[model samples]
Target: MTMKISIERLGPRRMATLAVATLALFNAGCMVGPDYHRPQVRVPATYSELPGWTQAEPNASAPKGNWWTAFNDPLIDELEPLVVVSNQTVRADYANYQEALAEVRAAHASLFPTIGATGSATRERAGSGSVSSAGTLVNSAAARVVNSGSLEGNVSWAPDLWGQVRRTVEENAATAQSSEATLANATLSEQVALATAIIELRTTDANIDLLEKTVDAYQHYLDVVTEQDRAGTIAPSDVITARSQLNTAKSDLIALGVARAQYAHAIAVLVGKNPEELEVAHSAAMPALPSVPVGVPSTLLERRPDIAAAERKMAAQNAAIGVAVSAYYPEISLSGAAGFTQSPLSGLLKIANYVWSLGGSASETLFDGGLRSADVDAAKAAYDATVANYRGTVLGAFQNVEDDLSGLRILAEQADVLDAAVRDADRGAEIAFNEYQAGTVDYTTVATAQATQLSTRQTALNVQESRLLHAASLFGDLGGGWSTDELHDPRHPAAPAAAAAGSVQGGATSAGSGEEKVQ
Candidate 1:
């Protein structure tokens, strides 16, 4: 008689039940670690500078979801969407975010059992010399085949007993969120760059047109002076001066073309194309600056992608501190394996031959020469560093909004002055031409008036371009219309209201006299 022993402790059904119960228990509580809370940062209630700008009540209107669309430039709206999808920097950031997401998934997977299926087949024959029990003279040995197949599973869950897994998940999630914010920021930047480049390119084209017309006028004046000299009405020296002025004006026109080409090339690169392949033949006219509405200062926290990214990083680092601290606790793991085996292939399916194993493990680092403690200290230090960095980012964001607002406001005023200068110059040029036509003024006076008028007009156009660029900066710093909802993932800190308020205070110095149109 043979004593039969059942080695399989857990049946397939039992193993499945255990796995489900374990998962339920593991998931039964709030994730361990310090939940993030936004620390207080000083921010002013209103902007102090309202210099020259008529102050108005703060507009509580949320930023237009697509702030650039507020510019009402059809081209801008058409191009910005592509920037988020195809721009290289945004693509790279998106990839990083996916990677972080993968890490979180991997970490989450560790909380469950690992299952596997295994099979093996083997053939064996005994040698005559090795077969002591068989006939010594046996030259042939019987061949035997053994086949086995088993299904098994193992579980090793380091219970968040100390919250290590939770903290790690928190950290990874924050990193993933940060990557998302960074991607948004990168996309916003690309869109702004393209918008600004197009504006500058158009401005260049306008300048070239103005310079060409001025060159033509100068050439006409040169011809008149040459004819007068031939008739002995003007000296040869006067004719020479007229010719030199015409040549200089033509040279300026050529220089303007070079600048235009450069701006075109820049725009081409922004739109993801080679300079030679681009054909932006927009000769219509320079775009008008858009009217920008400043919302409450507190809105800055929700609108800026950079600030959101920084805050996410802070959240990640905060979780890291918990991860470091969790190292001090014991780690618990539950493991189990179940399968079937038999000497005969037919017996493999029999319950009697089934085999299984189950176990639990607990461990803690007994000694590491204070290394773990040092790591905890280092993580805490890193958390502090991130806090400081987050605060600095918020401060810088406020400063940027203020700077752009001041710049745009002042540029708007300057444009008004430049408009007057252009008008005066045009009148002077007209008067000079009339005098020349009457034979009272020399060709030199006509040339001077033409050059001055053209220069003033070009300057005015350049200022208009500057105003548009400053507006772009203002829009960008204000967060490209990203909302606080986008910035706040419930897993992280609340909106930084003080920072937003500070931004408004810093930006609010100048108000519109009475809703004057920017265009």
Candidate 2:
């Protein structure tokens, strides 16, 4: 219903009372939608791969510190912190969060009245042939000019009579929360990437060091064989074989440089620098493999930022259903305008020149070929999709954590076996060389033993790298110590200091390595 009221009939006090009553009625309108409840999800009592997993004894009483710090590598500690500040991907997501906050604020604005003012001044002129103001037909119309001015202030509000605006604000607020969680997830992911790159780079350095020492040993063997040939003990063919082995080792050592340089370049980029702009110094040892504490499955729901983001989206979508349902009700609005208009250009603000309007409107779309119903259906469908997405995300998170746990557990056992193999191979190579010198074995036997030693040593290095990489993977899958509770509200953003304490705070199982550094 639309109405027009004259000031002469409805007095100013009555109009004010009407507006107040309208506000009260709308404020009491029932919110029409399903309230959000976290959907039930199947969570395991314990991680599937937790059995026989080596849980780390991280000092709980120790001051909170970075997850990478568990590796005890200064380089990793320094570079890992930079990923959040300078990573372009994280920065882009943060910009997206800023936009989401603006959207929330915009939606919130709809819950209140909109006040505006308008002012206009116009000059009009009439000459011959123009009708006179008195509607008289004069033979010669005299030149006349009139000036008019008007100033008006108006207020209009829809009042959320069926809670449509409130529901919309709820939806946008949830969306902003999801955006914030997404930002945290991105930051965590990039930081893990940086840590992984640094770990691999250090592993490469260790490999290069191993090859260098092997090359040196081959050179020494060649020298001893050359002397034996001069003494007429070893044949010339054996001398030639020794030289070939030395040259092969030298080539293998050189090949490792290519990989080392590439890993370094990758590390530099991960730290937000051009490959050439930054260089990681070669460390003599690889980082220590950290033991991850494997927490129960249910903790993942709150721990993973991606999970939090997905859950928040479900809420936002659910609110959309309320917004759609609200369309079934009539839109009730109240508007009032007060102003003065005068043509004499003198005392335009006088009571005689005052003009005012007080009105209300109720518009119901009685026929739309089921548009509102279709919209409601579409909203419900979208909401269902989000629920599925949220569950899938949770399942994926569990899969990641389990995969990391299994890899670390299986690899740690292999590391132990390889460590023993390396020790045995070292002894065999020593014995074979001594037997050749003592005229008890052939030079070919020495070469075979030495080859076995090098192969086993290289295999051990590979396994060690695998373990470290898996540890980092587990750290990330566990949400990198983030919690949904930390997700900032759009209406009340928190400061940086309010964020999580520095720590790799999560439960993970063991991928423990032997008591050996990268060497």
Which one wins on lDDT? 2
**Model 1 regions more than 4 Å off:** 1-19, 27-33, 49-65, 126-136, 139-151, 433-447, 487-519
Candidate 1 per-residue lDDT over residues 267-351, each given as its tens digit? 6555555566555665646665777766556667767888788888888898988888777777777666666766545667677
Clashing pairs in 1: 46-505, 47-505, 49-509, 50-509, 50-510, 51-509, 53-511, 54-511, 297-500, 298-500
The TM-score leader among the candidates is 2
Over 4 Å off, model 2: 1-21, 51-65, 126-145, 492-519
**Candidate 1 lDDT (Cα, 0 to 1):** 0.70
Clashing pairs in 2: 286-518, 292-508, 293-507, 293-508, 294-507, 294-508, 294-509
Cand. 1 TM to true fold = 0.84
Return the TM-score for each candidate structure: 0.84, 0.86
Tens-place lDDT per residue, model 2, 238-293, is: 98888899898888888888887887777666655666666566788788887666
| Candidate 1 deviation (Cα RMSD) | 9.2
